[model samples]
Target: MPDADRPQELPARLLTDPEMINACRLRDFARVFRLVKTKAGIYPSMIARRCELTPSRVGEVIAGRRHLLHMDVIERIADGLRIPGHMLGLARRSWETPQALVVTEREAQQPSEPEETPSSLPGPDVDSILAVATRTSLSPATLEAFRSSIEDYWRRDNQHGGEPLRPAIVGQLRHVVELLKEDRPPSIQHGLYGIAAELARLTGWTYFDARQYNQARAYFTEALHLAKEIDDRQFMANVLACMSLQATYQDKPADSLALVTAAQDQARSAIGTTPRVLSMLSMREAFAHATLGSQARTHEAIKEAHRQFERIGQDDPDPAWVSYFDEPKLIVDTGIAHGRLGEAATAEPLIADALRREDHSNQRGRAFHAFWLARTQLDQGKLDQACHTATQALQPASAVASERVSGHLKEFYDQLAPHRQEPVALAFEARLREALPLVSGSTRP
Candidate 1:
């Protein structure tokens, strides 16, 4: 049994009964145990053996004993179960405390109206472009050809100046979503869902590029949910990976690690192999480790990432998001992770290689590369070079729209503040002051 006074190892329940009741009401203990079993697949006896606890104690925890206060034992159980600490913490807190409840007086409550029928849900606007594609005089083959043409056009235009096309594309996708909701034929609905997910992904990318991380998160979450409904595991994995990226940008490395871990599990369950998925997981792990200041783990993850990236071949890979996992991009991200870990000597060379490979066409990648290089230079005490590089990075920072990149720039500026009197430092300070407000929502002049 756990020691009552020492609750550090246990899951996050409070010492009092009210907290325990709340935790029990929320099924916190059960959830944690289940998650543990899910991750480690250990039987009760095996878990007890691994945790060095009596089998009876494990049983009690599984059975929800409110007085079991040995937090260390709980932590050991979590470790034995291979459950992440953050999740274990959530389980403990939820189990131990009554979540604040929203109360409404009976007099304040209004009588409920009749619920709307299924038919009341907004149906596709048949007058829209998708309607034209589905119900038009054009043949199915012609419609498909037209759709392909539009996709190609959008891709090309996006690389140039396609900002104006987004509204139209969003409208078309919304119509498709509506049609799916209205019980369109399964085949047609599936296709429409794919299109909608793609559109949502693009919108999320746009928001991410614009440094609107919260808005990007909403779009990505919607995309992931839609992908799951359609059983598109690959797309689901991509969406989860994107969420991990968003979490990292928000400076929540632990949450980022958890998201990526979940994403990796989802990706593994997907049919067939995906080098890109593996690579993404590897990169996220490496970056998370870097953020957490774990140098050895970061290197290990980067190695695994490179191994996965090496497995990609023209015919062996899923073409969907794999195209974005090219050598240069991978190197740039690796460099960024290393730089974050205070490895300027090692990181500088990688950043140099990445910059050499960077083409102006990839504005987003270029911006990120410049930012990483600037960061590396600053860390190496090359203030003049860092400031100049930061200025170049800031030029495209607004053009791409990534909160992660903006955050990096801000950190770089903060680091340079002690050297503010230097010309290069003053220049960086001025540019950062201008750009910071745009990305960070600060209105101070």
Candidate 2:
């Protein structure tokens, strides 16, 4: 929550500017703070005063010695800088924007029509590409370079967070989209669209990880369009599946189930898609069913997913994107689906196994799995263990720039609410508060 008693007036040079928004979204505080001082004529101490952070800490962060990792810090920065909550992964800040300038997630909850296309969303102006005397030729090497960059950023997202890499992903997507305007060999044109689609999907997924649903949807819609333009049915199915995953988290279980079912149909119609891809889509169906509290349907979907997964082979012509859906990922997601349905006994061991094998550098992943383990423990009445496990997760949760991880921790805190009077629970709450202090009351802005 933002501070309600803060000043009602917003600074004229807040993140309403695209570049500043990109910098903040990328978590480049050093450059951003420096830009504020040099370009906006705002000093560091003044920034500290405005954002409610210590001047020394602000300096450290600006100097690259500290980070803005916690939600409390992010929320404070949003409130102080008059940054829109949509950009910062917080609830809407108490500030007014020009109606012509933005339509927030809250305001745009219901899509205007049954199908919202990319053209329907406000985004980077594709028609405003910088005019050039000549265009560069699209080549296999260039496409491979773009693919390598996307892969590198994907790895970084798994290790660091989606927020820090979001701007880079968006930049890459824009660059690829721009490249499509150049005249290219007929064979290479489709490949360019494929790369653009993948970049768009990556950008959307990064936004999703940050819990910025509207931005995510815009990119996903763009990706879907690009994929369809190339007639790349497999990629189309994958994008639809990602959209379904987004709907699931947004608490629209029926929408999720419908999207996954549509994805399955697309996958079945595609010529070259492997069983691995189908398996991933089926697993998503299990998630939707679990969300809907349909025990029979959930198990049926899970078993179907397993059967499809078993059919996948080493020589299968699966896309690189679906490669992430290995045995370990399946186990983790299956556990999560079961956990959602309150089957703690079924979920606990699988989650623990996945956590044990998880990469230590993947701070976000570990926090996510650990939170699931804690949830299962709490569900099973193992309060002490759940508290301890949640405490262990808190450090990584604080370090990662993921709203999903933050949301999980908040849920853990609420789970312990009933036991607040207990000594262990009190101690746990103290630790959580240290990591993520829930500021009371609202600022005026």
Candidate 3:
């Protein structure tokens, strides 16, 4: 039915192959080229022709002699090959079929992942979805795609910080809002509302990280409204926890404690709640108590957090966002809570051990923890070691644009002012000046 010499659309088998997925995730183009050739029978020349690249360049890529990083080039490959944008860490592409139709149905211009999507594999056949007509309403597959995209958004935010990601996230959030305007079934509406709530909360988090308190509050309020619309208590707990943290940043520990209390209440009866969720809320409680200067309550909350963590079973399913709140994070948060309570001696080792165990791709986390480690060292009066540790932090900070990290550094610098004449402090000063000039919006938060 098709020309033997012609390059057919990539088979779904190749697209869904785990190896190919990993390669794409890593942006290993050389491996991608090889896979396309071996698995899809699309040779280098054909690949080049379809992707609008020179044959030699394609050959070089296949041979592992070249790499592709430019956005324009990446887009061309995606468009030319019909690769789903999520596969490439991109927003859904322009040519993707509308996810849902009103009264009239139309042919789909694209095929996407299935319900639950596997970061999932079992779904309708790719060719059928690629060639089949539209649905009257959004399907579970569509929701899965949205969830997948959101997961990627959070991953990128964790690794790279949120400022660079806000535009795409906001665009998707707006699209989800527009989708809500359509008359959908209650199931679909709730799903859409939950996603919208998450996006709003994430937007608020971005603003919070940037120290834009007013904007953060506005978006957080909007997220709460959306979460309430669906009676999604789990989601509500998550949002309240975010707000609780933000309140602490704003130096309102009493408000933080109240918010965390509400979060704990919501989480208690929330369906499908995981131990990690309970543990995280307790950590939030601990943070609030620490900020309030109640050492006894802080220790009690921290113990509760650990108790909840010990209850975490491997089979305990958590919300994707909660995945970040794992063992290393719990340890670091404990150290941080103690540090906030001015117990530097109790904090330093926990923070240091967690840092060593943290995932390297999480540059922002590394930077944040590194600052705390440095601060604890400084508080223990280890001037030279503290300066050295703080200097090391600049490596991760340089790789991400986070106002929180910058602000913490600024606070540390101010603390070092009395020691400015010392060589270690001067050396740290030179490095800081060279690395960031102290990004202007930085704050103690």
Candidate 4:
């Protein structure tokens, strides 16, 4: 029998590095934590960064004082450290079921208490309102106001990206938290919790797009906790799907696929499974497969996504959160999936068509899609066309505060390294250096 004190040994298959086979096998979160610090030459800050936990929290976990057993947290660590699930006394992760296990209705009831209260975070001023909220009945109109504010912020985020609007959203989140503490009817409380989760998720996604990943992860974790507290399965699935997208952007395709699978499972358990939402999750799976270089799997996921999308009827109860995933999103994402697998010829026209239809107001998204077009051009060895597409991409990229766009530009610069002697390539390289800010190591692709 394996010693209870001993962590299951680290295997060579974990990270696919033969040289790392004999590395630290400590399975305890704390032991693994300390081992990560000691194995600086191998993993460095990969754990803290990829898992979206602060260094201090990782330290606390290593010291055996922090709560590290939550399902989401465990999955984060398992993916980040490339630890096989079996080693952690969990089931195997794969492309099929991935990391999904059904979260039963009984297990998803509202919590008796809030998950974690804010102790040190700065928030909106609500001292006056808090007293009134406790004594008086919560008004439905007031709840409606909060919902409207959140919806407005969502629109703003979609148009402007997250950097410029995060502060306002955070302010709204603080106000909602204050309201949540007020004495109110159970129905009012439920609405408050749902809005709070929505605000938290918005904050997280903005930070994510801005490439402030640790902060983003922290917010997403809070949103997940709130979603669980209220048993809001739809929002739970949405948050998980967003997390999967983040994993994809970070190039952790295996983890991305797992998270998407979990999102799909969560959606299946929701009171009403909307096809729009299911299609979004399936598209995420397709993207993950593409990133992993699985052409067949990518195609399979894409087909499934399309099939679900076709099932959506005119009167389907589509939520506000998923209203953004339309035919345009599908087409663009299909192109992206193919592009990630290096199928430039098959990807370019679809991406180009989507780019033409993309909203002009969404400068960040337009720039992002343009970058993908440039990538496809480069992949096809059309260096001149790539340079031109990249130049057009830089127009909006320069106007945005997103570190992610800058990262893409940086990657494009790397592609130009070989042709630096060519005047067009040299000029674009110089232009990019002057246009975009240098991304920090944490946000670099």
Candidate 2: Cα lDDT at 391 = 88
CA error at residue 29 for candidate 4, angstroms: 15
| Model 4 TM | 0.69
**What is the lDDT, from 0 to 100, of the residue 37 in candidate 2?**
76
Q: Estimate TM-scores for all models.
A: 0.63, 0.70, 0.68, 0.69
Q: Which ten residues in a row have the lowest lDDT in candidate 2?
A: 436-445
Alpha-carbon lDDT, every model: 0.64, 0.78, 0.82, 0.74
Off by over 4 Å in 2: 1-96, 99-135, 437-445
Error of 3 at 313 (Å): 1.0
For model 3, how does the per-residue alpha-carbon lDDT over 1-445 read when each residue is reduced to its tens digit? 2568443678899999999899876668898888988988888888899889999999888888876743446667877777776677553555554546411321122122222546445354663464345535798888889999988888888777897777777767767876776789889898998888888888888777776665566567667777887888887899999999999988999999999999999988878788899999999999999999999999999999999999999888788879899889999999999999999999999999999999999988998899999999999999999999999998888777777778787888888977999999999988887787434344322
Model 3's TM-score against the true structure? 0.68
Highest-scoring model, lDDT? 3
Candidate 1, 72-149: lDDT as tens digits: 444455455443333333122221323342123211111111234357444445335555567633234643653574
The residue-by-residue lDDT of candidate 2 on 1-445, one tens digit each, is 3668554344555556777778866656777778677766768897898888899999998889986643345656766766666665444554545545435534333222234348665433443443343455667888788788888988888877876676677667666665676778977888888888988788788778877787677677678878888788899899999999999889999999999998999889989889999999989999999999999999999999899999998899889899889888889989999998999999999999988877788788888889999999999989898989998997888777777877777777778777889887888887877777422111111
* Residue-pair clashes per candidate: 13, 11, 1, 1
Which lDDT value does model 1 have at 371? 74
Considering every candidate listed, which one attains the maximal TM-score? 2
